[model samples]
Target chain A: MKIGMMSFAHMHAYSYADSLMKLGNIELVGVFDDDLERGKKVAEKYLTKHFSDQENFLRTEMDAVIICSENTRHKEMVLNAAEAKKHILCEKPIATTIEDAEEMIEACKVNGVILQIAFPVRFSSPIAQLKNLIDNGELGDIVAFRTTNRGQNPGGWFIDKNLSGGGAVLDHTVHMVDIMRWYLGKEITHVDAMVASYFHDIDIDDAGILTLEFENGVIATHDASWSRFAEYPTWGDVTIEVIGTKQTIKVDAYKEHIRMFTSGAKSLSNVFYGNDMDFGLIQDFVECVQKGKEPSITGFDGLKALEVALAAYESSEKNKSINL
Target chain B: MRKIVYKKLEKIDFATTTAKVTIVKSADQLTEGIETFLVDEVNFDSVINDTDKVYIPSTLLNVVNENLYVYYELEQYPFFKKIKEVIVNPKGVLRFRRTGIITENQRLIASDLVVFSAILGEPLTIQVKRTTPAVTPYHTIVTVNFGNGTMAHLEYTFSNDDEKIELEWSGIKQIIEFNSAEMNPFSLKNYTSLPLAYSVDSILATARKADQNVLNRLEEFTSLLSGGVTK
Candidate 1:
């Protein structure tokens, strides 16, 4: 199978490229980036072709393409990929707007191509185990979920609203929301949120706390913030506390780590040694496309998560809980 | 220099179980041996039956001081220094809620007494109504209010099947940690490792220094515990 990367706007594109290279019987057709310099640099680093033109990159004999463009650029890229008859594994927050997301999903459907969202946390071992335990009724009935997905603010394009859509609420909320939606097998019915820019002097929000109610009567609270300082052990973390009637299970995605306290560093740093979630996600996408099977995480899953995040922004703006 | 020897009783009927004495010049040695001799050697059942009123021990107060000392030396972490209050809920029920600066040598007496009281197997001071018997499922929440618009939440949940503890410190810098699970009580192989923010050697050296300070504050801590000091 031949897979080409659409853009290197997001950092994960490099990791996904590494995943593609490691897999057997798959060829990394090369990369395409709107920024010619970045495209050339990444292509040179990977020792592959750099297609400066989008049309030429899409016309290349590739079976699938992974889209890691900016949030706002996702729609255009997905539409282009669909028209080119290429299967897509797009990055999360599928698009800046719900309408854009719906259009992307429709375009993929009309083109009869698989559109998988990069929800890599689903591939984490601890998360998979937690889901299994919940499915086995080990936690009786999940009454509520408290989740956090926080990262240090990645400046530049991320802070630019025109490029990245929104701020921490948009960038961070969807991953946990997607996981909860998958775990409960329910849609969020309502959202109440408070977003603030308390941490940074930037124009966009850096912190958000959202409360969501699922159709299955499960209430969840999510803290999506770029609150970690530079000295933090890792870049960020995703933690979920599943509170049930019988028992509670807490899942920390980056828990598999060794804490090292060196003399030079100001604070202790955690060295994580966990399975590469991106590798697992890429492998699944490849296998699904190979077997003509539906993606484990569909584009609609992306749309559902995006809807909740958008609602969170709306709730914060109106200072009232928004019904979904 | 002073030597304080603590004896544990084997049976409630007996006056003492066995007596051991260790001579030390400072409070550091007192703390080092207190855990071994006072906590480990005592027969839990005997201690429960023999004491009618739970008295907060001066040695236990030293432990809290030692903790504060270490925290102070370790960059004066805001979570430790800014703690304005602590609410401990053992067995998933509200037990004691004391409001004051915990790091202050003067304000820790009441809080220290509460911990010492719980360790003695006395029923926790019930501040709120509980639906279930405050037993069986063991869970404790040590919430430390920073008074600076922030707080640290330390929680421990233990059941017959499993045991887990979590600590979350947010604001400025955030740390969310879930401690390792404890499966069997009898198995010496099971151990929960504390995540150290500093190197073990540095911490040990700092601990030695902090122990001396803890000892220096011992008199004041004990005086507060004895209710001899008004403030």
Candidate 2:
């Protein structure tokens, strides 16, 4: 499969490039970003060529396009890619609004193009195993779930409300929300959330906490914050604690068994790094494309996740429970 | 001179990989006996048997072999309980052997109390200490200034042949700046006061049933914040 990247502004854009370049079945044809210089730099860095405009780039004899431009720009990119009869691997939250997300889906369907949301957590090995366990009744009924998706502040367009939609909640909550929907096999019926700007002085939220109740009466909590201190060795941890009727499962993707001691005046911070999630997710996407099947997480899955996030935001805005 | 002893914990990098460090501390100069411990980035729990025999936690026993001794002043103004000793797990990724232990000084710190990520990676040296360090909500940056000294060349080179790596050591360094400062961690209670989607009603109801006062939870939670909050 020949893959071309539409933009490099998204955080996972580089990871996608790295994945496509390394995967045996997929060959990267070219790459582009909104900025020519940035696109050229990324292309050169990844050992790929650059395209001057979207029109020319879409016209390339590529099997697919990975739309990683920006949250707001996703709709147009997907529409254009679909018009070119190119399959899409779009990064998540799909779009800033449901209208745009729906349009992206419509365009894909109209053009009979495959559209996959870039929700990498769905492809996580542990998560997949956990889902299987739940499906197989190994854990019985799930009682509660607690997860933390944290990181250091992005400090870029991520802090801009208009560009990124919202702060940590919109930026970080979608991943967990999407994963929760996948795990619970139910829709998010209600959300009550609180957002704040405790860490960064940015107008957008630097921290957010959402408490959710799925339609199946499963209770879940998600802490999506940019709270890691700069001095910490790594960015942050993504931990999911699932409490079932029979057993409790804790999935920590960041913990390593290795330890270090320091007798010097300095102190120690952070335990591990490199969850390798991006690489893992991208590899799965490439494989799915090669197998001629829909991605495990489709564009609709992305939209559903966005619905939960939107409900959370609406709940926060209204200071009340938002019923889906 | 006053000295503080801390155990090595886990080492974390930018990619969320952790390396555990286990250590044994003995005060040969003052106290007799040994102190065994398991340290990670978060918790330090251990057992002290006699003055000479310290039973280090077995979970981290594989990572460390030899014991280390850290010495601090026994006679301070008045904070001296016993000889101050602690096993530090730098990253909160591992657990100690036991739940709690009493130091010689009689200070009963919680087994899970952790000094947040203070230092990691290669060690840097500082010459001067500034009393009022610049602070960000997430970190404290200390600046070291060494105006003019001919002999103080600011940098040196050292590497043990056994370590198989060369290390450049800079003597006098400054923090220049730090942004993260201490803040109270945020918990589930803080969100109760904020408006939310109705889908969370059940969760909020459960929180309420757990004896949390919904109306005052926000004030109490936010008031507890000196600055930092965690999930």
Candidate 3:
């Protein structure tokens, strides 16, 4: 199978490209970025061809393409990929708005192509085990969920509201929301949120706390903030505490790491050597495309998570709970 | 002759106090037990003053003591031998709605003393507060930077009756958590359940020595209280 990359705006593009190259029976055709210079640099570093034109890149006879462009550009790229009949695995929040997400999904449906959203946390081993326990009723009925997804702000484009849709609320909330929706098999109905710019002097909010109510009567609270200091062990973490009627389960997605304290370094760091979530995601996408099966995580899943995050912003602005 | 003397002393007016201590492996279960003890066993009437209360609100000494013991054990391993620093970050909510006239600063000092004594080996660094006006239920999260990259990520909530204490030693490969009612005592179970009956004589001797250390600190804290209290 041949797979092309759409852009390198998001940092995960490099990891995705690396995973694609390492997979068996799959060829990473090349990469295309709107900024020709940036595209050339990434292509050179990965030893792959760089396509300056979107059309030329789409016409490269690839089965699918991974979209890692700016948040605002996802809609156009998805539409173009759908037009070319190429399957897509787009980076998260699907698109900046609900309308665009719906349009992208409709376009994929009309073109008879698959559109998968990148949610690597679902592929994590610890999360998979927790899901199994939840599915088997080991936790009884989940009463509530408390989660935190905090990371340092990736300064440039992420902080620009026009380029990235929102701040920590948009960038961090979707990952945990997707996992919660999947694990609980429920959709969020209402969101009460508080968003602020506490850490940095960015135009967009750098911190947010959201209280979400789901259709299944499960209420959840999420702290999605860019609150980690410069000397933090890792970039960030996704920790979820599932409280149930019978038992409770807490999962730290990045716990499978070794701690390393060095004299040269300012703070102790964690060296993770766990299962490669990105590789797992790419493998599933490849197999699904090859076997004509639906992806475990679909575009609609992305749309659901995006809806909650968007609602959080609206709720924050109005200072009232927003019903979905 | 000793039994007759003890019986005679029992007739005198002596202060009596009750304490319920539970050592659990998981800090998550700490609250349920604590709450139950507070409701059923603790004599609120007997607590004539804040100083008389054995378990101060938000000090989280139990959680820190638990982590410190684990850190000491983990240090024995070759992996943690080279560690030189530690950090403790304790963030939690303190529900002060029911307790009239308590302030966030008082609760913070109580909580800070526990952490300071456990990780820093003393409460000398904690500053006393005066005029602690009542604070509404709020979240208290403080990060302790024990210089040299040893840090603790302590996150807790002392508001609304929901309690959670999570302590992570960044320098050491250990995480001690006490949330809600789930208490997996982890390594503390052994020390808590040591064979007191078989080694009663030796244990008593050691307890006497430890008691002196406690009394000395009590004296120091009492003296500091004069200057520490808010006017």
Candidate 4:
């Protein structure tokens, strides 16, 4: 399969590009990034061609395109990729607005192409085990879910409102939301949030606590934030505790690491040596495209998760529970 | 069995448990020179001025008289007490995001309130979401924002006959986990006749500083657990 990357804006793009090179029977045809220097740098590292013009890049004979532009640009990129008849693996939180998400999903549907959202936490081994436990009724009926996806502030354009849309709430919430919806096969019906800007001196929210109610009467809470300090050992985490009638189980996706006492400024750290979820995600996308199967994590799935995140902001603004 | 999990006890007779105190169910049970009255949380309003000393069982809403003493089970848990000490200072730590608690009983979040207040000062908002309709629910999650502009998320799960409390904050290279053991007796952590005085004062200040809406939500939560209604 021939694949092309739209941009190297989100850091995940680097990991995905690396995965493309390692996987068998796949070729990263080229990379198209508006930022010429960054595009050139990544293409050079990956030993691929770089295209400055997005139209020229999309005109290439590629089966799929991975969209890793900033949050606001995802819609334009996806629409353009769909117009060119290239299958898409768009980053999470599909777009900044609900309308944009709806449009992206519709554009792909009309073009007869698959649009998959990037939710790498769903690719983690522990998360898969939890899903299996729930599916097999090993944990009985799930009653509640407690989750967290917190990371250090990825400053650059991530904190910019126009570029990334919102702060930690937008950046972090969708990953766990996608995981939960995938696990329970239920939709979130309500959202209540306490959004704050405490960690850094930024005007955008650095932290948010979301209280969500599922259609199945399951209550869940998620702490999504960019609140990890500079000296903290690792980046952040995606952890969940599933409360079932028979048993309760907890999964920390980034837990498989060795504790290392560093001589450098970061005094202590956990050296993660687990499944590279990013690779797993790219591998799955490749297989789906190879077999002409619809993407497992569909664009509508992305829209549903984005709805919960957008509701968190609306709930914060309205200061009341938002029924979805 | 000397095991007391302290899950919102409505009729715990401190008189029977302690050596010095006495429970005043009626005038006959009261001693001739009964100077103190041990009362649970709900009856504090009725017996405000009836005694020189009131042994508060679980938690109180507002700051009452100086005679009312708060006995927090958190003081008995060495691990939580150590965390409380760190939270009060928090000089080097940048931020503490979320706290997860699991236990055998849905014990009062009184100690949690104290701990959260120590981190985030006065609570500006309080919201509770529970999983089951069971009076003793299997799961409950609470979100609160303090007057200091910081927020805290706490999740409590009632595991059957097993006790464990796990507090987690992630993404800094290290993930911390705490598993609970049986609590020991309280030590001389405070001054004369005032145990957990700082904590009690902070919780009261939090209550006093909170808006009426926040307090009402807390009241509703207590009522729901006690099989009653609050107007």
Q: Which candidate has the top score in lDDT?
A: 4
Q: How do the residues B1-231 of candidate 2 rate in per-residue lDDT, one tens digit apiece?
A: 111123322211112212222233433232323222222222222322222222222121212212212111111101111111221211111111111111221111110111111111111211211111121101111111111211111111111111011111111121111101111122453323111111111111111111123213323322322221211
Separate DockQ for every predicted complex? 0.07, 0.02, 0.04, 0.25
Off by over 4 Å in 3: B1-164, B167-186, B190-231
List model 4 lDDT by residue over B115-227, tens digit each: 45656576666676776657333666666666665555566666544334555533223334444321212344221222211232222222222235444544544544444
* Poorest stretch of ten by lDDT in candidate 1 chain A: A192-201
Q: Could you give the DockQ of candidate 4?
A: 0.25
Sorted on TM-score, highest at the top, how do the candidates line up? 4, 3, 1, 2
Candidate 1 residue-wise lDDT, A32-73, digit = tens: 997999999999887889998999999999899999998899
User: What local lDDT does model 1 show for residue B162?
Assistant: 31
Candidate 4 at residue A91, lDDT?
A: 89
Candidate 4: which docking quality band? acceptable
- lDDT, each prediction: 0.64, 0.53, 0.62, 0.72
**Candidate 1, superposed: residue stretches over 4 Å from native:** B1-167, B173-231
Give the higher-lDDT candidate: 1 or 3: 1
Which sequence of candidate numbers ranks them by DockQ, best first?
4, 1, 3, 2
Locate the minimum summed-lDDT window of 10 residues in model 3 chain A: A192-201
Model 3 residue-pair collision total: 39
Q: What does candidate 4's lDDT look like per residue over A1-324, in tens digits?
A: 999999999999999988888896788899999999999999999889999999999999999999999999999999999999999999887998999999999999999999999998888999998999999998788898888888899998889999999999999999999988998999999899877676678879887888899999888888888878777888888999887887778899999999999798889998899999999999999999999998989999999999999999999988889999
